[model samples]
Target: MSLQQVEQIISILNKQSKPYEWVIQEFHKVDELKDFDLDLETFELLGLAFYLNQDNCLSLKTRTTKIKEETFCIVDIESTGGIKHGQILEIGAVKIKNSKELDRFNTLIKVDQIPENITELTGISFDMVENAPNLKQVLRDFKLFLRDSIFVAHNVRFDYGFISKALHECGLGILLNRYICTIEFAQCCIQSPKYKLDVLKELLGIESIHHRALSDALAAAEIFKYCLSKLPYHVQTTEELIKFVKTSRTQRKIAI
Candidate 1:
């Protein structure tokens, strides 16, 4: 679709305050999107970028709902620190439900060579992954393991971005899993001088083999459980937890 057409739709949304269904009806008027194979729900999902109010289209705002009785996958990855330019060396994750670990996935990815700095930082060397499976195979396996669970990580964006990019390059497509960053959760729930994963591990007395993907992921899982316990009693669903974390972070930033 053309930029002008998209702009026109946004303009319509801005001027007309209507329900989400009404917005879709208006979107149908657009020539580009009219023949689009996607359905109304899919189209509304895209409207999330515009931050449209599902109930009443007024101003742009983030939308989050409840997430009770859902599964979570805490994930971590060790890479060359240049995901866009370099390679992923390892991936580790743990699936959790009802605050209990359901399963685990850990693997080393074969790479041409591991950079000296990366090896020093992660303790994963060229020799370690030389015989391991390639990125395509590892990503395929990880995707199956991950399924549709909510993705959790210390600094979620980093791991999520790297994995998403790796998957795309491997022809696996983008990751669509909803994700929560423990860093944000910790900031909202804990009182610590620093919110780094290692620092939290030390403060909480959680044993960890720092810099390894699985170890870090396990640590993050612990932190996530702790944060969940500290959440308001009313915050039960995944959507509520996410919204609470984001709102709390914003309030903390304003306080600072």
Candidate 2:
């Protein structure tokens, strides 16, 4: 399908609360799309983008029959907070399978300077990263480390966006890995007054240091596991879980 057609499909899916099967049926009704051969993966990717656009939650198709069998790479990053202009100071990720942590990746990027305020926040100083590897090298290694595992974070957009942009600048291109947001999942799965990582850390009694990348990533991973355990029995697949969370958020907004 053409890029425009894919975008149109994504737009329609975003504005309406229809599942992939229903959306595909409606798309087939269009004379233009009727002749086009679109595969299940393309449709699912577009549907995945619909939710990602809503709040940076991207779910990819998984061959695993159960959630526990799937692999998740829970990631977190500490950056200069400059968005387009800032640089990433550190990256941390933990790979989990079958609800158990299998491995971890952590690194600091060399930066010429870091603001005092940022240093104060993350306790990462310019001196610390001065001798660390460059962005390109770190990203190269990180990309390989990530593989095809599902990308996850507390607020997925910020971390994922920064990493994606950095990768592009380093000639690595955008990350197509499906992402999940613990913050969004927590809002859907738990009735919490606040869903901030620190708040949830205290509320859920998860032991971890705050602010640092690895610790925060570990905290998010814990929350993710907890949320999965609380998911409805019918929500088994990744796609179903994404739909359930999106619908729950919509219902909550309407109630408010």
Candidate 3:
């Protein structure tokens, strides 16, 4: 699926208000999404989540949920090198609800080879993943663990884009969960010389192994919580937080 299409879908969802009105049953018709397919395939390929409400109308889950009640899955991955040509070597994630971590998903992905440079960076050698599960299995499991929770990462786009690409390559659909990028979100909350995961890790005094997937994911989770605590009173819904990091989307880019 085209990534641009997913972005377009997100724009539509972001603009939706009082989600109940969009429910087909309530309106006796599909409005904004009349031409949009809300099927499983569409949901997976677009990285969005919606469900049939008690009224039997489809409603966007993230839009209605309060930020304090939302669940977030902070994710990080280690790959061979590049998004286009590389393979994911490891997947690590932490599930957060109400600012606390409740569970984690961590696994190594089996690959044919590991480049030396990648090994030097992440310290994950081919042998490290030699006995691990295959790419498709790991991704399938990750998707299950992810559920409809928000997909969060340090540089949201890279991890999100890479995983979406990897899933499609494995014949799985793209990720449709709403996501938050710690890098951009941090910029709105803290003053830092740089917002790289490692840079913020040091500035924020977050302790973790620098390059490993789980460690990095934990570090990003810390950053995610920090940013949340700094959010203005006006921003309370999950959709508001999702739109907060992108300056153009929110009323004003918050800088503390």
Candidate 4:
């Protein structure tokens, strides 16, 4: 219902993952918990809108799905500035299934202002967004394109956090999908000196435009697949793959 509620779902799962009973009780809302029927209806509504699942797991697809079978939405966004006040100028995503790009979504969002420096960096002026769809409509469409896939982005926190906040602002609820940062994921698998999408794209010889959303998303999709090939042999399930990148900080420190 709220960002905090979605966050509560994620926090509980990361700590004590399982079915509804264990998680619902922890919410201090056991009175609302039921083994079936109405409870499932509630969760199904949450799941349909926010990616929460009937199993009470926020990352329903990531829990047991194999890495090779999972569909990853590699995304990139050009925003006006900071997440707190900025608007998304553009958003682009590449849906990757079995290490191949299966679908794509790209759109500019209508806005009235964009800082000069932001314009310089992303080449996205207010004029460019003038005729585009509003953020709410774009978010609703993006949600449909996103489906239940794992979200991937270079600096995932910014994109994921920003989009989640924007979605909430648009009354779309927060994203409950599992996500992975390519920078973190790359650290676990590659020896790149820099992890910025443009930097890694150059290092990896991925040819694409630098700042635009769709081009960058395509580049990130390449990076995601490239890094996937380098993952430890044991990283089979989507859970293990997500876990692998998350534990990268400590694991990479050992090599340093």
Q: For this target, which candidate reaches the highest lDDT against the unseen true structure?
A: 3
Expressed as tens digits, the lDDT of each residue in 168-248 for candidate 1 is 666555554557899998888777889999899988889989999999999999999988877777776655676688778
The window of 10 residues in a row where model 1 has the poorest summed lDDT is 58-67
TM-score of 4: 0.82
TM-score of 3: 0.85
Clashes, model 4: 0
**Candidate 3, run of 10 with poorest lDDT:** 23-32
Q: Better model by TM-score, 1 or 2?
A: 2
Tens-digit lDDT string for candidate 2 (1-256): 1334544654454444555456556566644355434445444322232232254333233522357766788999998876687889999999998789989999999987898899899999888997899999999888777865778999888898788778656755456555688888888766678989989898789998888999999999999888887777887865566566657753443111
Instruction: Give stretches of model 4 more than 4 Å off.
Output: 1-8, 11-59, 249-256
Error of 1 at 177 (Å): 1.0
| TM-scores for candidates 1 onward, in order | 0.74, 0.75, 0.85, 0.82
Task: Please identify model 1 stretches exceeding 4 Å from their true place.
Answer: 1-68, 250-256
Q: How does each model score on lDDT? A: 0.73, 0.72, 0.78, 0.75
Which residue pairs overlap in candidate 4's backbone? none
- Write the candidate numbers in order of decreasing TM-score: 3, 4, 2, 1
Q: What is the lDDT of residue 221 in candidate 3?
A: 96
RMSD of each: 7.0, 8.5, 4.9, 4.9
